[model samples]
Target chain A: MTNLMRGTELARDIVLRASEKAAGYTERTGRKPCLATVIVGDDPASVTYVRMKQNRSHKAGLESRHVALPEETTTGELVAKIRELSDDPEVHGILLQHPVPRHIDERAAFEAIAPHKDVDGVTMHSFAGMSFGHSEFVSCTPGGIIRLLDAYDVEITGKHAVVIGRSPILGKPAAMLLLARDATVTICHSKTAGLPEIVRTADIVVAAVGKPKFVQGDWIKPGAVVVDAGYNEGNVGDVDFDAVTDALITPVPGGVGPTTIAVLLEQTVDAAWRELDA
Target chain B: MTNLMRGTELARDIVLRASEKAAGYTERTGRKPCLATVIVGDDPASVTYVRMKQNRSHKAGLESRHVALPEETTTGELVAKIRELSDDPEVHGILLQHPVPRHIDERAAFEAIAPHKDVDGVTMHSFAGMSFGHSEFVSCTPGGIIRLLDAYDVEITGKHAVVIGRSPILGKPAAMLLLARDATVTICHSKTAGLPEIVRTADIVVAAVGKPKFVQGDWIKPGAVVVDAGYNEGNVGDVDFDAVTDALITPVPGGVGPTTIAVLLEQTVDAAWRELDA
Candidate 1:
C-alpha cells in the first residue's frame, strides 16, 4: 500500500488552529490578524496565486489587504509602498508577489519588508534565521515542508537528504532546514554531475527544480520519503509520480501549495500576537 | 604524484597586493586601513591569536587597535565596546576573538559589529551574503579556503564536495562558498551517520570538525583534494596526514591559517578603500 502524504488534512488542521487564534485576537483587539500583499503587474498566474491567498485568509478569519501595481512600476516605488505597509501598525504581516517585471530590483524589494512583518519570509534576515536554526519565522514553503515531515513522524536525523535546486527562497532554505534537523544534506543543482546517481543515495528527496516530472522513478531508493515541492503547469510535480513505487510522496496540487498558504496564515497570526504583546 | 596544496605562498602574494593598496589609500586619504581587535578575558590561545593578527596588520601597512576587557564583562558591555569601535571612523574592520567567555552571549557581541566593518565576517549579514553569493565581505577562513582552491586551479563545478563540521564561521560558510562555485556540496556534522562512507564520495573535502586526526587514510579516495581547515591543539589537523597517500592535501600548520589572515587583511584594505571613497 502506497502512502500519500496529503497536505490537505494537515493544512486544514493548521488553518483551523490559526482561525481560532484569529478569532480570539479579533475579539480582544477589535481587529483580525492582517496580511498586506503587494503585487506588480497582472501576470495571470501570479494574479491567481494572490487571489487564492486572499480568499483563504478571509476564510481563516483573517484580513488580507491587497496592493496592485502597474507593470511599469519602478523598484523605488515598490520599495516605498512595501516600507509604508511595514511601518503601518495595522498590517501584521507583509507578502510581496515575486518576479516583479524583470527590471525592478527584486531583492531590494524583498529586503524592504520589515523582518517582523515578513510573513512570506522573503527577507535576507528570515533566510539567515532559517539557516541558523533560530528565527521568528521561516519561508512559507520550506516551513510547511518541515511541518509536513513532522506530522508524518518521518525520521530526519542522520538520514541522507538530497535537495535538487539552489533557488534562494526555495531550494536553498529547504536544504538549510534539513541540515538543521540533523540530516546530512547534499545540494544538487543543474551543474551537478551524475544527477540520477546522486539522487540514488538519498534517503529523503526534495524535488524543487521547477521542472515538470524532472525526477525519474529509477532515481529514488525504495522506502525513501519524497517531498515534491514543484508545482508545474499541468498540475504535475517535479517527480514522475506514476512511475514512482514503494515510497511515501506528496502530490503536487494538494501537497505543498495548500500548506504554504496555511503557514502564511499561521505566521501572520503569530506576528499579530507578538505585536499585541508589545 | 601527490600534490600538496599550500596557502603560504599565495597568502604572501595576496599580502603584497594589499600592502600596495594600503599605501595608496593612506597616501590619498591620510589614514591607514585599520583593524580593531576586541577580546574578553585572557585565554592564552586567544591572546596569541589576537596578537599575531595585530602583528600581521601592522606589517601590512595597516593600523591596529586593541580592546581588552575583564573576564567579568557582560554581553551588554562587550556589545557596547564593539559598537563604539564599529562607529569609529578610524576603524575600517572589526575582529572579535572567538570563544568569548562561556558566560557571555557571543552571537550578540558578533552581531554588534556593523556590516561594513565586519572584516572577520562573523555577522548574520555576512552569512546571508555568503549563502546568496553576493556581499562585499565573507567569513575570513571560508573566504581563504575558496582562494586557496582558486589558486590551485582545482575543478569545482560539477564536482562532489563534502564539508565536515558546521560551525557558523567555518564549516557552514565554507559549504556555502563551495555551493556558490557550483559544486555539489554535502554538509556533515557529529549527528551524521556513516561518516567514513560519506567521506569516500567527495572529489574535494574540507575538514573543520576541530578534532585532532579524526579522518583516517582509508576514509578518502585517491586523487581527491583535501583542504584541512582544522587547527587543533598541538598543531594537528582533523585529517591524519602521514597515513594518507595519492591525494592532494594541505598541511596543518602552513595551510589554512596564513590564507585566513591574508583574506582578513585584504578585506580590511578593501573596506578602507570604500570608506575613503565615501
Candidate 2:
C-alpha cells in the first residue's frame, strides 16, 4: 500500500509550533509578530493567495498588514512601497504577492525587500543562501516540500532526486535544497530528452512543471518517493496522482499547498524572533 | 585518440580580445583599466598567485593595484579595506585572493567587494547571477571551463553533465553554469554513493573533488567530454590524465589554470568599460 504523504498533518504540527513561538514572542516583546503582504493590480488568484496568507498569519497569532496598490502601479512605485515596508519597524516579515503587474519588474521589486525581512525568500540573496545551504528563509513551496519529506522520514542522502522544471523560486531552489542534503540531484527541464527514462531512475521525484498531470504515473520508479509541487486548476497536480504506485506520494489539494502557508507563517515568526533578539 | 583540450590556446584568444578592448578603452577614456588585488597574509602560494595575476594584467595593458594586508588583519579590517577599493572610482575591478587567514570569515570578506567591481566573481551576487544565467563576471575557473567547452564545440544542451564536488566557488558554480546552458546536471560530492557508477553515465564529466587522480580513466564514458578543474600538488588533476580515452580532456598544468587568469583579466576589462561608460 502506497502511503499518502499528508502535508496537512505535518503542516498542522508546524503551525502549532509556530503558534506557540508567536505567543511567547508577543508576551516577551509586547507586540505580535507582523507580516506585511504587498499586492499590486491584484489578480483574483493573487488576491486569494494574499488572503490565505493573512488568515494563516492570524491563526498563528501573528499580525498582517495588507497593502493593495492600484492596477496601474509602475515598478518604481511598487519598489518604493516594498522599501517602505522593509524599513518599517512594525513589520517583522514582508511577502510581496507575485505576478504583481505585467509591466512591473518583479525581480527588482523582490530585491527591494531587505534580506533580513525577506520571509518569502524571493531575493537573489535568499536564492544564493538556499543554493549554498544556509538560508534563513527558503522559497515557501520548496521549504514546504523539504519539511514534508522530513516528516515522512525520507532519507535524502545518497538518493538520486530528479527535479522537473527550473523556475527561479520553485524548481531551482528545490534542487539546491535537495543537493545540500547530500542527494545526488538531477535537474530536468523542457529541453531534457528522454525525460521519462531519466525519471525512471530517480529515488525521489519532484514535479513542479506547472502542467496538469504532466508526469504519467508509469514514469515514476516503483517504490520511489514522489512529491507533487504543482497545484493546477481543478485540484490537479503535475504528477498524474492515480497512475503511480509509490512508497510515498503527496496529494494535490492537501499536500504541498497547505505546507507552503505553514512555512510562511513559521518563517515570519522566525524573522520576528531574530529581529527582536538582534 | 583523445584530444587534449588546451586552455592555453583558448585563453590566449580571450586575452588578445580583452587586450584590444583595454587598449581601445584607454585611448577613449585617457586611462587604462585598473584591477585592484587584495591579499591577506603572505601564504607563499597566494603571493605567487597574486603576482601571476598582476603580471597578466600588465601584459593585457591593464593597471594593477596591489594591497597586501598584515597576517593578523581581522575580518572587519579586511572588509573595510575592500569597501574602500569598492568606492574608488579608479578601481574598475576587485580580486580578493582566497583562503585568507584561518580565523577570518571568508564569506563576510567576499561580500565586502561591491557587486559591480566583483571581477573575480566570488561574491554571492555573482554566484546568483551565474545560476540565473546572466552574470557580469563568472567565478574565473567555471567561466574558463565553459569557454573551453565552447571552443571545442561541445554540445551542452540535453547532455548529462555530472559534476563532482560542491565547493562554494568551483564545483557548485560549475554545475550552475552547466545547468544554465541547458544540460541535465547531477552534482555528486564526497558523500555521494556509487560515485564511479554515476561518473560512467555522464556525457560530460567535471572532476573537481580535489583528490589527485580520484576519478580513474575507466570511470569515464566513451566519447564524453572531460573537464578536470582540479590542479593538485605536483601538477596532477583529479582525473587520471592517461587513464581516460575521452573525446576531449583538459590537462592539469596548462588546462584550467591559464583560462582562469584569462577570464579574470577579461572581466576586469569589461568592468572598466561598464564603469567608465556609466
Candidate 3:
C-alpha cells in the first residue's frame, strides 16, 4: 500500500506541545520564550516568510522580535546586529532569513549568532554537533524530516540513505543526521554522475535538489521511503507525486512545510527552557 | 600498468618546501614556526607518535613545545592548558594526541584548540570549514590523501569515492574534502550492510577502517584508485595490497604515514605565515 506521510497533522501535535511548554516556562520564569528574526533588503518573498514565522511564533506563545536592515547593510553591520541578539539573554532563538543580498557574507552573519541561541542550527558549532552526534538543535527541515521518519516508524539503522543535495543547511546536515542514526549515507550533488542510478539504490531517499519534480518515481527503489524536501514554484516539490506507483512519501504543499516551522518553534521553546534552567 | 602512488616521495618534496619557507621566515622575522604537542597519558604508541612529530618539526626548522600532563588530568585542566597555547602568539600550531585517558572528555579538549592554530584539524571549526569549502587546515591523513590523489593525477570530479570509516579526523573529514572537490562521496561505517558490494562500485576507495587487510581485492572495481590509510600491527593497511591485481593503490608502510607528518609540518609553517601576515 502506498502511504502518504502527512506532515501537517504531525506538525499540529508538535506545535501544540511546544505551545504548552512555552506557556509553562513563561509562567514560571516570568518571560515568554523569544525568537529574534533578522532580515536584510526587503525582498517580497523573504518578507512574507518572516511574517509567517512571526505569526507562528506568536501562536506558539512565544515573542517574535523582527530586525530589518537596509539593502545596503554591510556584512559587518549584519553580523553586529546578530551578535547583539545572540548576547541578549531575552532572545532564546536567533533566525536570519536566507538570501540576504549577495553583497553580504552570509556565513559570517550565521557564525555571529551564538550557538546557545542558534535554534535554527545554522552555525558551525551546531553543524559539528550534528555531525558528531551531540547536536543541541538541528536545522528545521532536517529535524522535521527525522521526526516524520520516526513518526511513521521507519527504521534507519543499517539502511542506505541517499541525500540528493549538499547545501550546508539542508542536504549536508540531513546526511549527517541520517549517518548518526546508523544509516549508510551517500551525498549527491549536481556534479554527481549517474545520480538516478545512485538514488535507485536507496532504502531511504531525501530529495533536496530544490528543482521542481526533480526526482521521478522510476529513480527510486521499490517500497523506498522518499522525502521530498524541495518547495519550488507553482506548488510543486522535488518528487513528482503523481508518478509514484507505490512508496511511502511526503507530498509537496502540506508535507515538510508545517513540520519545518513546527520544529523551529519547538526548538525555540526548548532553548528557552534550557537557558532559563541554567 | 598500474602505478603505485608513493606518498613518501611526495611528502619529502612537501616538507622540503616547508622547511625552506621556515628558514626564510626565521631569517627575516628572527622567530621559528612553533608547534605545541600535548599528551595526557603515557600511551607508548602516542608517545612515539609525538616524539616523531617533534623531531620532524625540528628538521623543518620549527620549534617543538611539548606539554606532558598526568594521567589523572581532568578535561577541564586539559582544556585550560590548550587554551593557554591557543592564546599564545608563539604557538603557530597545536596537536593533542588522541585517546586522552578513558576518563577525560576528548571532544572538549579538541574544541579548545583555536581554529587558527588547529594544525591537527580535529576541532569543530576545522570540520565545518572542511565541509563548507573554506578549510584552513585538514586533518593530516585526509590532507595527505588529497595531496596523493592530486599528485598522481587521479581524477576526482564526478567520481564515486567510498570512504570506509567515520572517525572525525580521518574518514569523516576525508569524505567532506572529496565532496568539496566534486566527488560523489559515500560514507560507510561498521554498521554498513553489504560492504563488499558497495566497495565494488567505487571509482576511488579510501580504506580507513583501521583493520588489517579488511578490504579484499575482489571488493574493488577494475582500474580503481585505492587509498590505504590504515596503520595496523605488522605494518598492514586496511586494504590487502598484495591481493590487488590492477588498481592504483598505496602500500602499507610507505603510503600515508610519511605524508601525514609531512602535512602537519607544512601546515604549521603555513599557519605561521598566515598569522605573521595577519
Instruction: State which candidate has the highest DockQ.
Output: 3
Instruction: Return the number of clashes found in candidate 3.
Output: 0
Better of 1 and 2 by TM-score: 1
lDDT of each: 0.93, 0.92, 0.93
Clash counts for the predictions, in order: 0, 0, 0
In model 2, state the lDDT of residue A200: 92
* TM-score of the first chain of model 1: 0.98
Q: Model 1 — TM-score against the truth?
A: 0.99
Any runs in candidate 2 off by more than 4 Å, and if so which? none
- Could you tell me which residue pairs clash in candidate 2? none
Task: Write down the worst ten-residue block by lDDT for model 1 chain B.
Answer: B1-10
Better of 2 and 3 by TM-score: 3
Candidate 2 residue lDDT tens string, A174-201: 9989998999999999988889988998
Stretches of candidate 3 exceeding 4 Å from the true structure: none
- Model 1, span A246-269: residue lDDT tens: 798998888888899999999999
Model 2: number of clashes?
Answer: 0
